[model samples]
Target: MADINIQRKKSSPSPWLLILLVLLGLAAVGYYVFRADSDQPVTTAPAVPSPEPAPDSTTGAETAPRPTNDPAVADMATEEPGGSPDELAAFAASDASAPNYGRRGLEMLMASLRPLADRDDLRDATVSEKRDDLTSATSRLQEQGTSLRPGYVAAANLIKAMQQKAYPALEADAGELVNRANALSGRTNTAQEQQQVRDFLSRAAEIVRALNQPAQ
Candidate 1:
């Protein structure tokens, strides 16, 4: 045997072993990154709720109930008085009793007519005075038609005719006006309403008759 001793070089890792170690190291690193990410708290946002619906305006459903039975309350509900001119006239002309509202309206019209007819100088009456009388009578008569009931349409026409005429001309039409008033009386349910209409006719007649009497 030669004196040279066979010395074994220190063994190096095989290429396959190095590759396996590198793959293991990479896998450990990936696992650690995944575990770190997983350890943190998962924050999810809370869900938002939808809004509620609004109420209606026109019906006033949310408000307290109104008192329909009370007269004062009923009056408060409407801005204008009830009854129509035609209906009021028809009612007055009918055998059925005129509603309190219409009956009262007749009384008011008669009141205004009385002063105009009873005037000593009706034919010679100033146009201003005649206009005032016209205004008062027409306003009251018009009110009869306001509350949704038929109003004194017939009587309103008579009033309108009177308003269109001169004092002397109105005096000439008084007889015809009287006829209209009497016609209104025939439609009334109550003696009082009829009598009121008659009184108005009588005053209209007086106005006409006085016009013929030559200034006293």
Candidate 2:
């Protein structure tokens, strides 16, 4: 057993060589880790888009309102000397025939009889005169807005006519007065005549005021 024995040499450490080996091992580890990381691209967050505002209205164009008519309102406006001239003109325009023609025609006929009344001849007085006298009396009963009150609309219309200074309208209004007078056909007495005279006179006063003002 002693004849064939053999031994290998054991190597001794070099400081510089040992250091170099350690550095090389660290470098290899770093390179392997970096190489793996480079294979995958860096993850990034997605971007968000902004939204736009919408337009208004389903259909195009904005429309304005139309004007309306009110008779009551129109009447209220006629409180002045010639308060509703335009309204009166409109009223006048509405009628093709004069509404007061009957009254005026009767007045004309009675005016002829004034001379007979002046002579105090009650017996010889014509039928037209009697009608006229009765009309005069009823009108007197209704003066200063007292009788046969048709409310604001009629009053405003009357005022408007006076304001306009339209001669034909004035004639029509006079006819209306005569008709109001003729409302009483058969009554015979001083009281009826006197009362009607007062009303007609009140109307006369309003007309006088309207006449005095300058036309608008």
Candidate 3:
């Protein structure tokens, strides 16, 4: 038997197998990157709050109104002046005891005289000293009429008629005027009002008597 030593050759792996292994490794890496991206939460902008509205300027508390003794005068202060003289006179005659009767009565009496005062005949006479008594009485009556009762206004009307030289009309209306004065006197409660009405009646009677007497 001959002593002979023999060595066997070792085989290397195929190139195709090495290539397949490298491709598999790359696919694993790509899959892991895609999975990480899918699992990550998306960031967004935060929400903002709206601003509140301001309060109104005119919504504050207001002051209370003042008290009044005469409600009609208070109401009249706020109302615009209107109505015809005849209409006011009608109201005066009908509503003699009403709260605004003073105003209505004064207006009725003034309506007759104001036109006469403005007339061409009376324009010069109104300012004359000869008419001083008449002018003074009416001026005071006018001043007091706003607060005084209707009886005073009725009395003033007679004086006004006499001053205007409307004697025939005054005489014609004398009975009616006296009747009205008497009725008004009965309606008044105060002693002063009664005394005034009495004076008015006496003056009215004297005037009627003087008119009936022949002029000297």
Candidate 1 per-residue C-alpha lDDT over 66-167 given as tens digits, one digit per residue, 9 for 90 to 100: 458763353234314423333334334444344553455444343444333344554344433553443344444434333311223333344433434434
Instruction: Give the range where candidate 3 is weakest over 10 consecutive residues by summed lDDT.
Output: 126-135
lDDT, candidate 2, residue 169? Answer: 38
Q: lDDT per residue, candidate 2, 193-216, as tens digits? A: 434433443443344344434433
TM-score of each: 0.30, 0.23, 0.32
The true-versus-predicted C-alpha distance at residue 145 of model 1, in Å, is: 8.6
Q: Count the backbone clashes (under 3 Å) in each candidate.
A: 23, 7, 0
After superposition on all C-alphas, the RMSD of every candidate to the true structure, in Å, is 12.9, 18.7, 13.5
Candidate ranking (lDDT, best to worst)? 1, 3, 2
Query: Candidates 2 and 3: which is better by lDDT?
Result: 3
The positional error of residue 180 in candidate 1, measured at the CA in angstroms, is 10
